[model samples]
Structure formats: structure tokens, C-alpha cells
Target: MSEDLPIRKIIHVDMDAFYASVEQMDNPDLKGKPIAVGGGGKRGVVNAASYEARKFGVKSAMAGNLAAKLCPGLIFVRPNFERYTEISKKIRAIFYEYTDLVEPLSLDEAYLDVTNNKKGNPSASLIAKDIRERIFNEIGLTASAGISINKFIAKVASDYNKPNGQKTVNPEEVTNFLEQLDIRKFYGVGKVTAEKMYQKGIFTGLDLKQKSLEYLDENFGKSGRYYYHIVRGVQNSEVKPNRIRKSLAAERTFSENLSSEIFMLEKLERIADEVSKRLAKSKVAGKTVTLKIKYSDFSLQTRSKTLPYYMSDKSIILETAKDLLYQETLNNSVRLLGISMSNLNTEANKKIEEKSVSVQLKFEF
Candidate 1:
């Protein structure tokens, strides 16, 4: 939409095997070993598996038993979410140092719009290199970055050189790169859609780009517009800062089903800490706090309470969540616990003065 302005510079940064890497970083002995950071018991799932484990056919979301069968000597450890959150915070602080137009996709990835950055770097590739180096030196983690004129190209470029690497796609190379890409590798083309495309002889970006808009729309519906633009290197998406949250939740699946109140309480404290940190980072406060419990049978029940005022403090959030949990009746052992904060201050008077100052600056600009 803002294409009339100077061609925008966007970067996507993704950490390689974030959870597995963090686990390996914490325990030096786990380095170069087939380690997974989830599931050590029956009915457990793998959250993340190291690259070494991946060589033996291990992957995230695979059943722990299946992963063990794939790699007989695989080591599994419970996730340390608190440590991961701490590291994410440190990395995000570094991103803000360069630009306020940072949009975090998750704890391990983000899109940065550096069109007019605080550091005044003209080249997005150099900024990406600096960010990746800073992350490695300061946070002890490997990050891969992609720099391009738009989000689509930037996302594709970032994956080209992964694990402490960076890649850039200039405007001139955009069309040629897309032409050779496999149809399946195009972003947003899932397995089912890719199979359909293959059956229709649309095996490459070149083939897709040749199809008329009406034809693509007939087959792919609303997403056809997206495909048309991306195939032609015409992405116009913006990197929006301070994106509002629809719902904020933190959850953990235990290594074993826990019926003990003490063990569950300890886990709740950690989850509360994570939720509080996210709330603080986003500068949001919620009036409602909900506690969710999933039983061993996979059935879930939730209980929530709304306070008169918004809360961002860790202790207050935990106390409120604990009270909600106490009020609910548990019929079975819980395999997972979740805490969500919602009903945000979407319209509060805190921004009135700020908006007035911004309006004045707009006229001056």
C-alpha cells in the first residue's frame, strides 16, 4: 500500500533450533549429542530435538516413543521455559536498539522494518549482519537473518543461509529468484495446495506467475491474490510495531501427569512469570486472568476472574491465578496448565498526551 514511497527495507530474523540450542548452551555436556528438550516418559511429545538428533529422523511434535525408536541413544530433558524467556528478552532489547519498528512473530523470530532506523544504516544487509553478530556475542546464540525490499523476499532470504548466517535479496534479483523456486517452497503453499499445484503443472514460481489472476482466484480463493503478488515480487506488507494482542496465554505440558498441588503450583509460578514478562514487554495490562487445566484424558476446563483494575505485576498475576485454580474443582490429574491474561486496556487515556504530541510532529514533518 505504501509502495509509492521509497522501496522499503525489511528483515526477518530467525534463531536456528532455538529451544534445542538453548538447552545445549546451558549444558555443555549436551553439545554435539542427540538431545531433545521435551518428553522423557510415555505419552509425551518432543518439543524440540537437536540437529544431531534430527539426523536420526527426530523432529519437533514427534511422539517421544517414536523419536526414541528413531534414535536409540536420544537424550530427553524437560523444557526450561523461564531460561528461554530470559534469553528472548535480552535479544529483543538488542533489536529495539536499532529500530522501534520491530514486530516479533514469536519468542525466537521477528520482522524488522529498518527503512529509517535509529542508527541511520542505509543498507539493511549490514544491519542484519550487525544484529546477528550482536546476538551471538551478547546472548550466546546463532541467528539467521534475511534482508530484502519486502517481507516475502526477506523471509525467503533469511532461510537461505541459516545458523549464524545472513542473506540479502536485492530488488533486481527478486524476479529471477522467484522464477526458479520450487512451488512447494513458496510461503503459504501447504502440502495439500502444493499437491494440487503440481497436478496442474504449476511446479515453479514461473508457472504460477504466468496464470491469470482470475484463474488463480478460481482455484485458490482469497489467497490467490497473495500468491500472484509474491510470485511477481510485489509484496506490500508493512512491519507494524506494537501490534495489539487478541489473547495472551502461557502453557506447559508436564513431563508426567501431576496431581500434586505443590508441583503444579511451582509450574504455575514459572508460567506466571512468563506471562508477566510478555505483558511488560508489550506494555499491556489485562483485567481478566484465566487458568486452564488439561486432564490426562485431554479434556480441558477453564476458570477465570476479572478484577476491577488491570495488573502487570508478577506476584499479583500469580496470586490471582492461584485463587482461580483453588476455586475450580479438579476431577482428574492434569497433564498441562495454562494461564491467560485478556481484556486488555485497548482504549485508555494514557496515550492522549502522546497522540497530541505525535499529531504536532506530523504537521512539522
Candidate 2:
């Protein structure tokens, strides 16, 4: 431990099967049962599942039919957003009591910096425990907490002990903890990156640390540096309290699938209008236009293009979205079509770089 280095007390809290647990809490019959919180339909997907359902290979984002096959007796329930929002509010209220430096990643998970909490509590572990207790006593839900010196380590540690357990990686033990960690478990290493690392003989944090900075930079680009530093427990990213919304999107499932490009284009026009309205409501503009397509088989894909400048014009947004759509070879009948804007420029509306551009795109089959 260096005397000049600064250390922080960061904690990551994640709810245990949040949606499914909420369903079970509302109905005693659903408790200790294999339940999934989502509809069972040809195109529907599971949002969350209880531990009992998870034992049978049921997981979130899985197709409804596959989830049913994985667990024949699985119970499916519709989601109640109002109820979930109410409970999430209660949970966030508890976090604020301990520290105002709370960063919620989603409704079910968040990061808290309890380094100088309002509770005047010196122990980060005790603060996490107290918050968990409050959630259980007040809301009747179990949560897992990970406490460490930084956000990266804290997020990883939170998953070390699941379903109401907590793990703390103190400042002095960070190096050893990361060294023993598996490469697949690293936050930024996705399935594709993991395969690449396996081919390069980098299976663990220690192996990753063995790579030279030049090698990492040459091989993995910007993310290569992230892995290099993370392996040595050098992550310094702060737990941001108010993260700006990165994108504003709108989507809808069609009553029937459309195979005709002309029909699909009409539907997309409506979807683009919806997305533009949302961006306007949020007062945000983005450089990228992404088109989301969901097929009859429930598979999803997206295509995006980043422009030279930001704009929220409906015509331009729709034009770009249409281009992205026609570029993709539609292999299946489309069940849903959506358009979104990302690479968000959250700065207030200004004329600094506002300009008009035109393009003529004609769809032909």
C-alpha cells in the first residue's frame, strides 16, 4: 500500500432475482416455486426468474418457449411496473440515508460510495449490511452486496457471494484477489474477447498481467489497456451518482409479422416518429441512428451509424434509420421494428453545430 495512493469505500448492491422475488412476495403460493416474471408467448422473453426456476436453466432474455421447455412446470406471470417502481423507490430511499453518492445501474442494482457516509459510520461493511437489513425488513427482498476499494472490484466482489451474502475486498488484499480471478469473470471481457484471450494464453488475471502494455494495445485497442490495468487492481473509475442517459429509444411489437419491405417501411415510419418524440421530450440529440429488428423466432439485432454532428430532426432520423434497415438483408419476417438514437449529446439545445444535410434513399426489392 502506497501512502500517496488514494483508496475509497465502494459497495455494489444487487437484488436477488428481483422481478421473480417481487412476484413471490405478493403471492405466498409463488414463494419457493419455480416462477418467471414474463409472458409465455411465441415472441415473448423472460425478464427475470426465481432461483428455483434458474436451477432448471431458465434465465432472463431467454425465449418463452425455451424457458417453458427448460422447466415444464414453470409459472409465468405478467410484470407490474407500478408495483416494481414503488418498491425500487423504497430501496433507493434506504441507500440515500447512508450515502448520497449512490449510482443506480438499474432498478435492481446500484453502486454506493460509503467512504464518508451521513451515518458517520466508519465501516463500509456495516453500512452495506445495514442497508441490506433495511431492504429485507421494509421490502421483504434479499440483496447481495460487494464492498471494495473501487467500483470495478466492488461490482465483481458483489457477485462473489450471491443471494443475501456480502464479500469485502479490502485495499490491502486487492492485488491478490484480482490475481486469482478468472479472465471470463472480468467485466469488459465478453464472450468474443474471452475466446480471443484463450487463444492468446490469457485465462486468468495473472496471465493477463503477463502481457506487455504494447502487446495489449496492439491486440485489443482501447479495451486492451482496460484489461491491463484491471488485472493489476488499478481501476480508478468513479461510481458516478448521476449517469446521463446514453440513448432514447422507442419500440413496439406488431400485431402480425410483415414480410413486404413496403409494409415494413410504413411501420418503421410510425416507429421513427415515436422515437423522435421521445428524444424531443428528453431534450437530447445523438449522432447515431440504430434500427432494431426482432424476427418471428424472437432473435434480435441492431444496426447503427454515427454521423459527423448531432441532430434530433425527425426526417433526418427516419432517413438514417431507413438506410440502416435497407442495408440489412432481412432473412426472416419481421415481428417488430424500432429506431433509436445513441452517442447521445445531452448538452442543452444550442446552435453551435446545427446544420442541415440531405440524402435521397429509395427502397427497392
Error of 2 at 139 (Å): 1.1
Query: Which lDDT tens digits does candidate 2 get at residues 1-365?
Result: 34444456889999999999999999999999999998778777899999999999999989888999999899999999789878998999999998889999999999998888898888899889999999999999999999887788899999988989999887667778888899998998999999999999999998998999999999999998777777877765667787778888888777689886778777778888888888888888899898899888879999999999998888898899889988968979989888888888863342233112111111110
Please give the TM-score that candidate 2 achieves against the real structure: 0.86
Candidate 1 positional error at 72, Å: 2.3
Q: Model 1: per-residue lDDT, tens digit, 53-156?
A: 99999999998999999998999989998988899999999999999999998889999988888998887888998999999999889999998777777888
Cα lDDT for residue 234, model 1? 69
Deviating ranges (above 4 Å) for candidate 2: 1-4, 253-257, 273-277, 280-283, 294-320, 323-332, 347-365
* Model 2 lDDT, residue 164, Cα: 92
Q: Compared to the true structure, candidate 1 yields what TM-score?
A: 0.72
Candidate lDDT scores, in order, read: 0.85, 0.85
All candidates: TM-score: 0.72, 0.86
Candidate 1 error regions (>4 Å): 1-3, 249-365
